[model samples]
Target: MAYRPAGLRTMDEAQDMPPQSPAPAGIGVRGWLRWAWRQLTSMRVALLLLMLLALAALPGAFIPQIPQDPAGVATLRADRPQLATWLERAGLLDIYAAPWFAAIYLLLFISLIGCILPRTKAHITALRAAPSRVPRRLTRFPVRDTHTTTATTEEVTRAVRRALGRRFRVAVTPEGISAERGYLRESGNIVFHLALVGVLVALGAAQMIAYRGQAVVVEGRTFANSLVDYDTFTPGSMVTGDDLDPFTFTLTELTSRFTVDAQARDFAARVVVTEPDGRRYEDTIRVNYPITAAGANIYLAGNGFAPHLTVRDAQGQVAFSQPVPFLPEDDFYTSRGVVKVPDVSPGLDQLGFTGYLLPTALAEEDGLRSVHPQPNAPLIVLDVYTGDLGLDQGIPQNVYQLDTDNMTQVMDGAEEVKVLLAPGEEVELPDGLGTISFESLPRFAAIDLRYDPTLPLLLISALAAMAGLSASLFAPRRRLWVKTTQDEAGHTLIEAAALARGDDPGLQRELERVMTAVRATTPTTPEDT
Candidate 1:
């Protein structure tokens, strides 16, 4: 018979009692914040954020970026204003620089740091501490072995410790010797995370400090490394015109080849570069072969022909005289160009010519087009216009397009007037407007220059990350124990066992090695030891 305490409730009474204090107030804001932090800093969340970053970058690849392809973006806007407006509103046109994209990048960076720091701290602590103690029952371990030898316990213990100490960190315990190896697995994990953080930092720095520009250099004409000289220049957030390298280069010659079917075979350009210190050198640029100068890489992106022309007003005074680069329209070099002669004689109206330059002219049934990529039958056919060239309007215009809004096409009877000329050929303009001469043809090379100071750091970080990942994946982590005791029969009994942190196919073999080491030092009997 037992007597219960007077104030203590029986099982029935406790069951009938009500809940206490609303279950302790539901974990408040601070507790919830701690939970959120733990979730965000988890390795799973870090990987998820990385995947999200990659997914967010996919749209940037397909969309025409405003910084890299401003013309393409402009054309999209002009063709589909509504769609373009929506894309702009969503920041797809400048996806890399978008606020949401930056947020994801920053979050991924922070998550990686958070995940790495705690793991690093724990790993350091583990490395400094001793190996784990041996289990009480070695026979229960998945990989275990027992051996009976005619030797003392001290001899077996010495042999086991010496054998395992060669490869593992051994610690003496009351039960036996505890040995551990492959801390490098955790070390590699920490290094991989650190490298990822480094890569993020380097990328962020590059985005803020790098700059790129494109310029067209005609043969025999020099191109200066300046903002005004570049046809299109995109600077980083922290970049400025003053940051451009002070250098100049002139396109000396161009060599191009085409197949019989008008497909391009090869293109190479020779340029003379002059550094800021007045040192000059010649370099060749071909497709995929870039030149490094003034801390920037110069790549030959495109090649075309620029026809030199001299235009004279009615008074026979030179009005516009320079080379005009034509944009290629086909594989055969059927090019289109516009000549805006806004600087005409004082009393004469401004003249404009919109035309096509056929490298190897061929008269087709539908129209005229180039038959070859070379200048075998070079010809320029143009339609003449007279107007207020709109130069004083302070509005930007495409050099390849002519605005006919304030212009009238010259007419000869019922048809609009047209002029045709070949190299060194001259033609008189109608109404005594001017005389236009095709002086010569020179090749032009479109080059892109880019400078990023963080490229080397980014490359190193990427390589380090790969190496650390390999180590983490291939290096095995294991903890082993070797216990020895003397039985009443004056025989030493040995129990060897191994435990792996993760999947280790060699755990059984490792335990066998320890058992073999113990046997080597002791006299074993043929009793299934």
Candidate 2:
């Protein structure tokens, strides 16, 4: 054999080795899938997915959602048809239910599960094992101390064990004593991720089984908990009519207050609710303060005026007599509304009216404008149309808008007919069609009812996540070592050092504290080496 140094190879031996081959072939489908899964399950991907979910929800806040505000969406579509089309196509109007948003949410959920399982297994293994063995060279640690004392090795070891046992998991051997603590740091990290997964699951359940409905109830009118009673109802995938609580509520009164400059000050809606068990109670709904009825939350969403009107045909038969809600158009309560009289007498064309209601009517140079939000001088300015009102066509239509596409505008001589009437005023329709009367004006309340069984779980999970995150951020993970040796002078030489998993500002202080505990047990003062 050639005289080769230990751990050395000769030229012939090196040449016999296999050459570094060209880059391996492309990873097969299975390998590629494994790589993808690993990448998707990484913490970085989970955080990125979370961020994407948050960003995707932003559009729902700014744009009008069909489930929440169909009227606003209708107006948007009418005003900006192109933009509305693009938004609808891109799912910006209904972001939370979008397929892409759901994909990110599902991916995040899977990633959290994937990360938690492996880490939890490892943590269990670590918990079963003892503290790591003492390092060969304790002097290599940044936080270190040495004490020369008259105490024997046995005394020094006992004191060190006693002191460190209070807070750390200690392991004593002939070489040294090894101690570790702050397992809760990793535990809290795992707990935080688990809590986040719980939150996501709760939220998904809520989305799948919850229901929300909105109804505009005029004062003295009853609203029943049924599909037909709601002006807008958005039900989750698993929700149905039977899922709604059987209840009935009537808006008894709605009070409003406004500042001099037409700024709204306060609004309250008093309602009488009848539960499914026949229990009746009176409650008030205010902005930001919701009332519970039949196990569902009733929120006061809006308040406006509904004018009580009566229409009579030429035969003196009552055609339409009910309150019609006029949606507000401006801060001053300049409202626009429509009335379709589809039940006119035989041989007479249906009647339709499109008009504006000025709460505090003021005759300006251009036209009538509202000066305040209060109904101090309520007036209605309407234009009459006579033809098919489109109610019997089975196609859903917006109640607040009038479709004059198949109707003819009533005319007086050479000009289009327009009627301006105050409260309790009666006006004769041109061409002997009918007589319209504005009887009274009563306030209406837009009440929203919501039900979700997973709300409490979601709340608890969110709070737990915050707590676990706090523990993970503040708790410190550190390892400590205490070694004892005999010096030439026959005194015990104690050496202690600490190593932390991350930056620990109190590491040096901890070393000092352990040293102090040792000094207190020894008979002689500690001498620095």
Candidate 3:
């Protein structure tokens, strides 16, 4: 007899009622779209997203980042403008803050949430339900063993039950025994996923609500939380100017030592800090040791000399006196800078001057050079330009560099300008410009100070993220089931099988343990003697 389709037969039997149209053979576009959505929201999709997220973060870790340090970025841009511009346009300059990077992480987090929430609900339901019944075909299981036992089947079943109860999940039956274990694998998997979500939330919260600021401190200077005080400030989106800490500190003393006899192997700086509360503390701040207090960190980044300069008008009245910071031009300690007398009293006169200070000044074919860092051969060369200094302009200017755009050199006065000066020496001014004087010098160490309210949170979140990654990658959900049965010859048969939803070494070890336990319970027969 030929077989007929079940649907066609049902339709023929119900022909007296009403013939129904056949359902479509294949799902249309809408159905396929729905199916695709379901797949994308599945656990497999979540796993793929996690892998992509890890891969996306690799470039940021390996490459230099602009958001971490803008000065370093500037240096790179100056060295390679074309490559830097392409990187900036491609969002590699600030990878963490890029839109594509943000999208990757956000989608990954959403995928995790989708996977974990439903899985948690399913796990809870399964936990409340009773253990499933043992399948009928014990021989079809992956592992099977046979033994002849003198004890009755009931007694053997009881002994097996007692042994399994100690370490496994047991389901007793009249014919045989069934046991399972390793349910904690699923529990650990859930924990690892939840921990990853926690880490992401913590890091996102810190990045969105934290504030960071940096300031350069010369030795013996105190600064407050003002706009003029900070050399660089990076505030989070939720942070405002008022969120800055009101504390102030002064670098009272700074000490530095270099390896003069050796090949400059060791260098260190010690700084004394005086807080706003009048408490004084000393900290040895070196290249590696950063001082932390009042939500700020102080690092001894560099050191230089601030020479004391004095200026007097033609009438022999003291005009200006202060220590001007100079930058080192060479490793041998030849420093060069300019001084502007904007506060001269002689009818608002302005003077432009350039000077080079040497610790151990020596004349060579290539002009003056300093032999050592210390001021052993103190010498100063000055070049004076007398004209309008353009101080009245409403634009900010660097004190270290002079802007002679609006200035002119006085007639013959440029020739008379002193190019070299020793200690306690003075260069008299003609045409009523001013008399430039070189006084004593004081050693000043350059300190870089910073305050980031969220640095601690960032560090904690990074560590937690690493831990979550390890847990998620190493933990697996697995289950082991052991079923035993009896044959006609009174031989007891044991079968052990395992199911793993993830790949992990621990799960494999657990399966091995279950097999070992089942083998231990099997009875052994003696050889034919």
Candidate 4:
């Protein structure tokens, strides 16, 4: 009788077990509860979890992330409040960081571990066991061949052994020979499943230890890795302010060029960065090029011009004279911003202001428009206001925007509506609030930097998964048996057969070659000649 493994018998018994009595059905009942739990833990359920993980990652990559584009998200929410609220409740805004997405990935990893651990142990045990005995009915096997020979049974067995030794895992018996090969397939399957778990663990570690942030570098400004230096930041759960790197870099120069004749894609910037250790790294950072240093990568995401301006009171004393960063409203040359003069030498006068249109600014029938981003024509249209500029209040205000809520427009009539000021020109305030003078313009670039230490581990896990998959899919397990008996005339009668647990085309061909080689080497006997 053929021996069957204990695990196989247990599997068969479990499948053969009778079904239990049907339970009463209702909404939110015990029957549905039990069914849901059973489905969630099953292999089919785990496969569904894997599919869900793949689907959940799609939106994060396809959609503009709120973490990366907060301004865009704010605009979207403002335009569609109801839809944004629904998406937020469904965890669509931040799908990758959501609890439900994490749960799916975690469960998939658990299922992979559960399936691989026992199979790996079983494969190790099977590899150590002795080769199975040859069956008595060799002719009934899937592959069988016979040939009469004058050579002794031992001689025939030796010839067969030599041929089988070339490629297969073989063992000789007194009757004939038994051989087996291709256990690597099972080993590979286990490896692939284990690697998947490793990948998930690496991703989880990255999420728990990585940090992303953006820091502004003004011209000739030097900054260290500190919370105060960063404009926006997103830190991993385990990362604290003290964990930041102490390395610092100085912005030696920042320059940009705009295409006067071509499209917006022709714009570019060159930034010079000098490390604290006196190492100089000069790189021409473009739209696609990102600089990496000190465990962080910096991307040249955007840029705008900071115009140098000087504000003076009626007495000719300088009130506010510095480079004010003007945010570009659109990609065109039209930039909009405010200039506030709360403190003046003449007196405590409130001066609220709005920037005028630059030269090359396109004007439609209604208002001013920018034809191009380049400053080919230079002009500034000023809108001034005078009132109580609430700068002494505890509440913070944006420098790029003016709070006209507490101020009154001083120049609202046609004669004062649009005061055009050319380059190196000045506009005198009617109420002795201040005098505005345009100076030079300097460009500034926005950069986003990120640091993740678990990238190497993630790559290793990916390679392991590939290796495991190749092994499992190409390797196979097979067995070969040879049974020999002497006929009445004292001549040896040999019968050889082969079988495989799984189909192995390569092993089948190898077995056929061995049988043919053995037949050719064995001597044939004359019968009644």
Candidate 5:
């Protein structure tokens, strides 16, 4: 039993109603599917799907993805085998190409399209229609005012119609004068949603025709735009080996400058670019600037040190000698690398050396460390290993690592020899096995070439979306009405009201302005009217 107001019903009357009944069964399979479709196309579902898509892409930023950095992914697997295996199996390492991520964004795209088409149709119909009818009770509106004037009803009505017609969609109905404005607000909302759909479509299409790859080139070495020349390559489904660009570039020199704290301040790579027509041009590549040629971009990603070494066997015959690029370990460029001279003399053991190369060698408490990134004084400290290198077993091995699982440590008696060498210096092995020489020092450049035809379309669609958002945010929708009637003294009484489609604080000021104009401009006397 509920308490009642003056005009409310009693408890007995409320209890007199019949009891509610349950809904009938048998909505059918078709009806259930229809319900599911409606839910999928709803705005709430669309927003949820958009959020899910963003969440799915978060892992890509932290994880080493296979498509972008296969070498990094391989290194991750070697460093943390179990974690990398689980992430790879779950497709976290390839988030964009994952099925679940694709499902979320594809559903979001469909949902936006479904939500936009109906709103577009409604807006088009509203544009073709006339202004709404004047309300029966104008004073009941949120913003309404009444003004009694000596002017006649005809003069007041004519003046209201002419004045509002200047800025709004004016209409003079038999009931009263009605005007509405800001139809572009709804159109902007529709355009914004449609542009989102365009962006999604453009990105999806771009993935099918895009191709990107990375390569590492030592100074004085040239890299060609071919699949065999790249250290890592990721291409679209439609891209073939023969479709690679015929352009080539040679890394002639690389220069890097650093601050006192060992932080890199500048990196530049000088190269001679050759076109397919045999025309060559020399240029320098900076960190912010990338070279664009043959419909692709070449970016300078990293710079590292490569040391030239000469290895010889017992017969003094040269066995393995080349410039090996060392991976940087810290800001000061303390590098670590492994050298494998597999082809020693026959009936002899394979040679392997793993060590650290310091650019500016400084003696630390524990061992040698790097104090700066510059090549003021370079040093290489290594530990020699011999025996089986497992090269002929057909197992792929990283060039920067030597598998010492089946190898034996070579030593001078019981202690391993600390083989250290500077530029132009040479050292002989402990067992008279061979000699190693430290030759010239060169820098390597890491370059990435990427080609995507849909970049321009993506940029245009993104700009369009922003433009639509600006239009929607600034344009406000409003409805105004001017009602005129005769008062008890036979004088004309003019009333105006305003209602906005959404929250608009300016409606009150607008209503007051219209009322003031009607009062001042209306004919005072009937003859003057």
Candidate 6:
């Protein structure tokens, strides 16, 4: 080398180095967006999104939903303020409608469509297209065989095509016959994806028109199909006031028989329903069974006691009279309730009472315990109060609670004075306040109403998904080629080969079957290797 610099590499050294082209350009915004689209549409991403959707539903399973239990949400907030604050902030109480949950739902939907559309189109194209062209070397196939035949090339080609045409997509040429079978493998895949998408769409449509609610129906009370009749109603966003079907039903009676261990063994409610068309019918609503009427199903969820009470002021005027349903606190049906008489004598004060009902009261030494669930020996105990009663300001109060903010407890200074009365008994207050009576113990049923128009469609789609999955898993795709050529002795040389779409274990067997069938028609040698 003539005067090469010390730091410079010689030609041989340069030749040994790998070629260095211009630095690869970074992808632009549009290119990056295309890359992201590909990633989002991939089956792996769709599977991940499905898993995320499942995880998003977990909170709904664990948390007490606000729509179903509005009062319970309030109770939780009061019980654990900080945890309630965090849960509310995260929308865990309303998991289904939360923005994050909807986002996952929508993403999974889009990913499934993106992952399925192109594959469906490709399958359709393949179905319409001709069988694959014959390869150059027949011996290259996984299963191949050659046999001698005393027949012309044209005759052999025509015979082979005719044989395979019955069961496969067959194509014939001067040199060979090419055929493909089992198009159902791809068809099943398409059906599986399409069915899954249909299931999702059907569920979404059902959710839009469905409504579920809870109603407390006491014995001898008629409940009409009205928004006001429901104790807690959660209607779909698309529901309107006019959508109600306008049917009515009365809870005639509720009967129950409990086990010796205090667990409920059997409960039944007799109901009489009136349809919109002036038709009447009798139905029984049980714990697991539902009563269906006018596209709505009524489920008997729970049962409790409602103490029928009557109260009179000092002037003997009826102040309050109704069945106040008490919430059960234990298995023995020991329950609590509230009563507020806001329209009492204007000069003195309004009266409020907080009380508990025992199904079968124990002796004083037993300390406020209930011995049974039946109301044969029912007792009501109440602590009275009197005050300004805040009804004028119109703040909503829970029917199960008393607002004691502007009230004075009617007590004996240090000990709270309580009135205990058995069924059909009355007690006169200590002062010129009122007279309280426990009239009867009538039971109430917590009934839930649900309606969905697309439930049948969802069921069909789910079945279709299962069927398609079975077909896709069990079907296989395969191709076969047969060639006919002349040997030096002027005799026909028959060659047959087979290839599987994947690693099919039955490819050689299928090849043997076809070869034997074709040879049976020809009455010639058909050797299988």
- Give me the runs in candidate 5 sitting further than 4 Å from their true place: 1-40, 45-108, 148-168, 172-176, 182-184, 260-263, 364-366, 412-416, 469-475, 486-492, 513-529
The local lDDT score (0 to 100) that residue 217 gets in candidate 2 is 96
Cα RMSD to the true fold for all candidates? 5.4, 6.0, 7.9, 10.5, 7.2, 6.4
- What are the clash counts of all predictions, listed in order? 0, 0, 1, 5, 0, 0
The lDDT for every candidate, in the order shown, is 0.88, 0.89, 0.66, 0.71, 0.86, 0.83
Quote each prediction's TM-score.
0.77, 0.78, 0.64, 0.62, 0.79, 0.71
Q: Model 4 off-target regions past 4 Å?
A: 1-42, 48-111, 130-168, 174-181, 216-218, 254-292, 301-438, 474-510, 513-529
Residue-by-residue lDDT tens digits, candidate 5, 300-340: 98889989999998789899889988889899899988999
Per-residue lDDT for 41 in model 6?
91
**Model 1 over residues 261-309: C-alpha lDDT tens digits?**
8878889999999998899999999999999888999999998999999
Q: Output the worst ten-in-a-row residue range by lDDT, candidate 6.
A: 520-529
lDDT of 2 by residue, 1-529 (tens): 7685787978888899998889989989999999999998899999998998898888888899876677678778878999999999998887777888888889999999988999999999998899999888987887998887888777887788777766798888888889999988889899899999999999899888988888899999999999999988988867888888889989999999999998888999998999999999999999999998777899999988999989999888999999999989899999999999999999999999999899999998998899999999999999999999877765568888888888999998889899888998999888888799999999999888898888898899999899889989999899999888887778877888999987999888888888998887757644556
**RMSD value for candidate 6:** 6.4
Question: Candidate 4, residues 190-236: lDDT per residue as tens digits?
Answer: 77878878888888887778888876565656656777887777777
Candidate with better TM-score, 1 vs 3? 1
Question: Which regions in candidate 3 have their CA more than 4 angstroms from the true location?
Answer: 1-210, 236-244, 261-284, 313-320, 327-338, 345-349, 352-363, 369-391, 399-401, 407-425, 428-432, 502-523, 526-529
lDDT for 254 in candidate 5 is 99
- Give the lDDT of residue 91 in candidate 4: 78
